[model samples]
Structure formats: structure tokens, C-alpha cells
Target: MGNCNSCPSKGNCNSDSGCSGLVPKYGKIKHIIGIISGKGGVGKSTVTGILAVQLRKLGYTVGVLDGDITGPSIPRFFGINDKRSDISQVGDGGEVKFAPVETSMGIKVMSLNLLTEEEEAPVIWRGPVITGVLKQMYSDTEWGELDYLLIDMPPGTGDIALTIMQEVPLEGMVIVSTPQEMVSMIVKKVVIMAKKMNVNIVGVVENMSYVICGKCGEKIRVFSKKTAEEQAEYLGLPLLAEMPINLDLVESMENGNVEDYVSKSEEYEVLLDNFKNKIGI
Candidate 1:
């Protein structure tokens, strides 16, 4: 047998085996894709939920591991609240594991908000503790078998984001951004960070790329800012999808039924198809 300690791949080998903090037994995940952004309010979680639901529609088992410990909205967006992870003994000698809560569409979900008493309660945790929780969500939670696990990552290149990039065996990422150029700078940093971590980027998805006029139905660029196409070109990746601002989606999110929104949106149908082709899913 070749000595893994002396091999030159530097622990980045393409193998099915899991590492120390991540074990295949917890999930045996086929792909781990993160939905990330450069800053907040770009609808990262919205894209995450839409992708998970859409992927499920394509007949693949899916799950979502909310990596945003302090700012967890994946649960709320899916109308999941007041639910805690079920604990069970995995084997002998008192080894316990937390099971991810299943959504209405049977998508496994785990998040800090689900564990907390109140959804509005502040996490108030340090960086390392938060990162530890993110790790435990994968290691300690029983995600079972899934074709794809979409991680709803928090905004910015912070400690938790770095932890996910470094610790999790990310297959690729879907970078979400708005039309603003200021936000593009942060998105560029995220791209650089992903490359540094040796993670493959599936493509970019621009949310709120435009707003449709209620009276005339004319598509209008909200801020007239630089779009994701230019940034994706700069990063040398494809622009997979661009979501326009729609009132129906806004109402769905307000009512905490994002899955229904994704299913009902005709635009999402085409977007999902484009995303699948780009990611080869």
C-alpha cells in the first residue's frame, strides 16, 4: 500500500473515503454544493431552497445543511420552526447522533435555528464555537444517503465560511450575487477563496437581476448596476441562472413556503434546467 503520509496530493485526493471530521456514514453524500455570496441580502438562502426543491423534482434525494449558524434562515424559509433534531444511539457504547429534520417534500434539513427555542433568538457565539457547530451538523447529524446536499452558507468570507470551504468536501459551489458592482468586489473575493481551497465552482446565479413592472411588464434593472455575467466572465465561470424580482416569490417567502414558490415559478423551471446542465446533474 502506498503511504498516504508521503503522497504528494496534500490530502486533496479524489476518493470516496471521508476525512477525520467528516465521515461517510453520517450521510454518504454524493455531492456537497454550497450556495454562497459576498455579502448579505443577496438571497443566498432563497437560491439554496430553490435548488434543493428543484433538484428533488428531478427525482434525486436531496438535503440541506444550513452552514449559517448565527444567521440561519433556511429553516424559516421552508416553514420549518419549533422542530429539533431527533437524537438516537448509532451503535453500542452510547454513541449518539442527531437526525436532520425532514421537510414537507422529504428534504432533510439541519440548522441552528431548528435547535434553538426561538427563531428570533441571537446565536451570540464565538467564531470557533460557531464553526464547531457547523462541523457537528455534518459529523453528528444523521443525514443518511443523499444525491446532493446543498449548504446554505452565510454571507461574507468569515470564519464559518472558511471552515466550510476547508473542512467540508465541497464538490462545487453556486455563487449568488446581486447586480451591484460593490457587491461584485466581495463576490470576487469569494471566488478567490474557493480557488485557494481547491473547490470547483459550478457557476454563478444572479438574484434580483431585474424587476418586472407591474403595469407594463417591462423588465427593469433595479439599480442599473453591473450584472453577474461580467463577473462570471472575469472569474472564468458560466453564468448559470439569473432570477428576476417577482412579487409571487416575495409573497411565498413571506408566508414561509419557498418550496411552493419554486414549484410554481415557470421561470425557475428554465433556471433549474440550465443549472443542471452546467453542473452536470
Candidate 2:
């Protein structure tokens, strides 16, 4: 490395000649992909967590917005429980700018949990109120620039999803499902909802399709087969992946750390690479 004794940056600013040192500019960010599943209890939030970590490890500035108001789980999945305090700083023209509480990865984030003191409390707002809050989150929070904003949507494509589709501008959506018929059928509801909203289909991911026996070295497909695969073919899109049932992953997640698996997993490499290529990243 060349001598940097007089380098203007402490590694946070630009080095443009004739210009004061400033935080480096990465340029305009383009896409926002919502991670959605048809119904609940299919490990959708875990999948989102894995994707977010993988994307960041690959050097993309990513953020997550937990749109699943009824039961926000993203914060817990990532093991982040920091209360989001409003940050106000006087800017040019005596104007005040507010920033949301960001996660440790430097990903700006906000959720209903941030405002509430307890996670078990229920959010029973009407459809319009819910929509208003989401709209405010988008326009108010200074997300700055992000390569991908993976939304962990609520279980079903209900009133909340409709309101979000009508309000927030999104690039596309990724569907998550399980191998069971009941689960796959429920998630199909979101697919229909996405179609009605005219959102681009990123792809589908099957979570917990099979489990590998610890001692036997045998793979058991407890859920059905050909569900996600068949759906992808019928929809004329690609199948993102089917994450195997790894007990280690479950332990890591429970300990508030899923990156323990996603970071070094080969499956993640293939899935993320495919996502980048398909989305023109």
C-alpha cells in the first residue's frame, strides 16, 4: 500500500480533488424486494434474515422493514432489540432531520416493536391506520440509499398487504413456502395478491423441505415434493431454493444468530448469485 499519512479520509469520506472530505458516495440505489409468504409459520422471517445477511456479506447495502405489524419477528430473528429512538439534528436552513434506530450491520430499520414497550402487545389498528404508519415509515425514515429493502411481510395477503401495495413503491416480491400442501396453498394467496398489485415476481423459496438425520446420514422429506418446483414452472419463474432442515440453524436462530449458518453455506452462494443475475444487480 502507498503512504497514507496525509490521506484525507479516515476511511469514511470522499477524496475528490478541490472538494472537502465527505462520506464516500456509493451512487443511486435501485431496487426494493419484499420477502413475502402466502401464510404464516413457514419460517419466512428466518429466510429473510438469511437473505439479508447473505446480501450484506456480498457487499450490498441492505435494509429491512418489518411490515408484519401483527407479529414483527425480524428484530428478534437478528437478535436486535435496541429501541429505536428518534434522532433529530438541525440541518441547513434550521431544518431538523430525524434518523431511525439502525441495526448493528448499519441497516436502517423500523418496526411497530420499536414504538411499543413489549413484544407481546397487540396492534389492532384499522386498515387505514396501518397503511398510514407504513407510508410514514417510508417518507419519514431517512433510509438514505440501499441496494435492497427486504420486507418481511405479514402472514397473509390481507388488508395490510393491500395497503402497502397501494402505498410503498416496490421493485418486486419474493415468495416463501414450505413443502406441505396446506402451507403452499396458503402462500398462493399472496401470489394472487402480488399479481393483482402488478408487482414483479422475483421467485419462490421453499423452507424446511427436508431434514438430514443426525446419526443416520439419511434425508427425510417430511413435507411434500414437487410443490415449489411445480409452482415455479407453472409461474414461468425460477425456484430460488429449498433450505434443508438443519438443526444447527435452528439453534443459531434461537440464539439470535442465523449468520452462523448463512455466511458459510454453499446454498446461500447459489441462491444469492441467482438473485443478483435475475434482478440485474
Candidate 3:
């Protein structure tokens, strides 16, 4: 209920701004998942995009909060870039909030990319400042009756990510990882940080776990030998998925449209369906 300074949950919190997101008695959502990665370039935002669409297809109200301050890509991934409304006051002067751009799938999305004029412009914000903005997004936005609020967090266990985990009441988190060995070690840091904050580990999404041969569709393990599955097992977590590398999928995402990027294989579909059920949406 105060400024996020010297809070009890230090390491887990990324920000301690003037955020009362969980204190309000007006309404609340069922699930809030933070899509976090151990490091960068692991397709964490891509996983967030697919998850929102799948939940909407199942007939649920979805909302996404782009928590990555320095690099906010969720809006671009959803084709809502360059769309922003002026901030207006909520009911009874509660807080001045902006309207989230609506995606084709009807998932309400918010990100700094939509607010900014340039997509590639560097956002030089400190850790505490970024954390305060995250609280503003959560408390100020018009996320009414959401079935899920998927937060696209920045890569690594840095200051901002830690602040959000400590201050915000997270329902669960989906850890994104590749099969690389060095990155696997950092993932343990993310897990330990989450545990320290008492946030639930819903599932682990292994992006780029393998590469599928174009002609024969043979699954090729591009990175480390048997490190990904081993990590999940050692952590005693459910292997949510093993996403294979696909170029066409990557190409589709470059334009910020995921409306038609459906997984062709049965295994991918099973993984998608299980994620929805696991989250109970």
C-alpha cells in the first residue's frame, strides 16, 4: 500500500511503486501468468501470443500486460503497434488509464510499444521506474472480468522482473527456455527467485527444443544434448511442451500477426490444449 521501498520481498520484486493492484475490492481475475525467460532470444513473447489466442478460441476473456520495459514486443507481436488512446480518468477519479488496443482474437493487449511512436527507439528506464510503470498498467488499465492476464516479462532475473514478482500477486508463471547449456544454468536462478516470492510455476515451455528437417520432418536437437528435459525433471516440473524450430512460424510473427499461426502437428495441439486446461480457462 506504500512506495515499493525496502519491502519484505526484496529479491523477488522488480518494482515497489505506488501500486495497489491487489488491494482493490472492485473485481479480480481468475489467473495471472507471467511469461518469463532465463535469458533473451528464447521466444518468450511468441509463447505469450499463442497462449492468448488459444484461450480466446476456448471462449475466454484474455488480457496481456507487457511487463518488459526496455524491450516491449508484445504489442508488435499482436499487430497492435502504433495504436494508443489518450489517458482518461476511471470511475470516481480512481486513476487515469488508457484504452488497450483490441486484437483480432478479441484479446485486450497493452504494451509500451503501442504507446511509443518508434518501435526501435531505446527505452532507457531504470529498474524502479520500470516497476512503477508495471503497477500503473495493472491498476490503471480497463482489464474488466479477465479470464487471464498474461504478463510478458523481460528476459533474465534482473531488477525489474524481481520487483514485479515481489509486488504483484502472480497466479502462475510459464518459464521459457531453449536447449542451450549455459542458459539452462540461469533458469535455475529464475526458479529459485520465483520460489522465494512464493509464485506458482504453472509450466515450462521449451522453445527451440529441436529443429524439424524440412523434407523428412525429422526432429533435430540443435543445442545441448538432453539438457532441457533433464532440467524440467530435476526441477520436478511438468514438461509443458517441446516447441520445435520452424522458420515459417518465425516469418509470420515478424509482421506482428498470430491469428493464423496454428500448430499443424497433433503433438503441438495436445500441448496447447493441455496448457489451457492446466490454467483452468
Candidate 4:
């Protein structure tokens, strides 16, 4: 109510805000969190997939909204690349609704790739069209009852990111970054944008922070001397997890078996705990 800077209604809203009405009408989504980054190639989608898988592992109903329209990869990661969503008519007005595709682990996923004829097809639409499609995907999808719906945001503070921040009723955001100083610097821009938009940041996850030696079981910080702890301290956010590069996990992702990796990885168990604590769930 202070300035209404972050409100979807902007300058037109009063104390009796109706911002919650902006959310999708068909689902009882308890939490809608965005996984975001300022720079690309920081494994933002990977973090999103991991968080969804971990939340699902705890018997919570979850959904993943692939907001990266141009480079949608959530469906592929969940092994639903070949699957297509079904549409149905609802209500007296006959509103069209989309049914999200379910993974083997029962996590719901909605992505532009799922609706496209080819998985590799490029989304070459303009900014307005892309944002419109994203908004429709969120509001028109029948997500059912979900404990968590993670929005895998596109890289940078572009139109899609700004649109989602303003329109979506996000509970919070999870920032993903890397060990590189340049990457951390770029990620801070996203933090600033989120703060200005009044979006709550849950924490930061450092992906590909280090690698373990296969021969002797030693940690190798090959990417940079700068650590996630330093980056988090600089950004004044909690360091959720310093995720190591595991060839096995990478292979599983490549083969569309992320759920399998989440099921068997002890490291993911720790990450799940950290995420739970940070999100206070």
C-alpha cells in the first residue's frame, strides 16, 4: 500500500487490493515461486527441475511452468518432450483450458515446447506475443491442486521477466548463479529488479560450483576462486546450496532421467532440506 510500485494494478490500486485475483482461477496452488537469473547458462532451469523433483519427493503435489518460452527445457528434463497437452472447454462461458502433462514422478509440467509440433522449434515471436502466450499459459491451464508451482523464468530482466513479476502472484523467488565473478555480478541485477518489484527472494543456489575428483574423491574448484558463500554475502541472501557438477547427474539429465537422479542422490536430500528451511515449508 506504500507506493503500489510492485502491485499489478500499479497506481490505480487502493488498500483493498484485488491483486490475488490475478492468479489462475482453476488451481489451488499454495505457492508460486520463480526460479530466475539475470544471465543465461547459469543452469536456472536445472535448478527449477531439481526443486520440483525434490518437492515431489516429499509427497507434495508440484507443477513446473516453463516460462523460458524461447528455450523451453522443462518438458525435456522431466522426460515429457514427446508428450502433448490436451485442451478442454469449461464453465458457462466455455473458456478453453489446457491440461498439463504429468511426468513419471507425477509432477505436472506446462511448456511451450509441449504445445509445439517439434521440440527443437524456435519461438521467434515478438516480445508482446511471447508475454501474451506466457500469461495465457498460466491463467488458462488447469493446474489442479498443487502445493508448489515453480516458474522457470527466462534469463535477463526482459519483457517476460518484468511481465511475470508484475502479473504473477509469486510467493517468492529462488536466484540461481554460478561461481564465476562475472556471473555473480550479472545475477545481482536480477536481485535488484526483484527488490524493486517487491518480490521476496528465498535464497540463492550456486550451480556447478565445483567438481569432485573421480580418482581420489577430492573437491576441485576449477571454475573460479570466488565461492558461492562470498556471492551470497555480497548479495545479502542466504546461500541455499553450492551444487557440485556430477557427471552422473548430467548424464541422467541428458537421458531424460532427472527424477531417477533425484531419487537416488544423497546430495539432493541435503538440497531439499535447505530449500524447505528457506521457503519455511
By TM-score, who's the top model here? 4
lDDT pick, better of 1 and 4: 4
Question: What is candidate 4's TM-score against the reference?
Answer: 0.91
Q: Look at candidate 3 and give me any clashing residue pairs.
A: 4-16, 12-162, 13-162, 13-163, 14-162, 14-163, 14-164, 15-163
What does candidate 3 score in Cα RMSD to the true structure? 5.6
Cα lDDT listed for each candidate: 0.80, 0.69, 0.74, 0.86
At residue 133, candidate 1 shows an lDDT of 80
Question: Which regions of candidate 2 fall more than 4 Å away from where they truly are?
Answer: 1-29, 87-98, 225-228, 234-236
Residue lDDT tens for model 1, 1-281: 32333222226676444243354346567778899988999999989998889998878899998988888888877888768877788779886787888988899999988777788999898898888788777777777778888899999889988887876667788999877878777888998898988878888888889988889988888765566577567656788888898788878877877787687667887668877887676
Query: What is the C-alpha lDDT profile of model 2 across 249-270, one tens digit per residue?
Result: 7787678566656787786676
Off by over 4 Å in 3: 1-27, 90-95, 263-267
Per-candidate TM-scores read 0.88, 0.80, 0.85, 0.91
Give the C-alpha lDDT of model 4: 0.86
Off by over 4 Å in 1: 1-21, 89-95, 225-228
lDDT of 2 at 219: 73
Candidate 3 yields a Cα-based lDDT of 0.74
- Deviation in angstroms for 186 in model 4? 0.8
Query: Per-residue alpha-carbon lDDT of model 4 for 194-271, expressed as tens digits?
Result: 999998899999899899999999889988887778879988799889999878887897898879887778897766
Model 3 TM-score on a 0 to 1 scale: 0.85
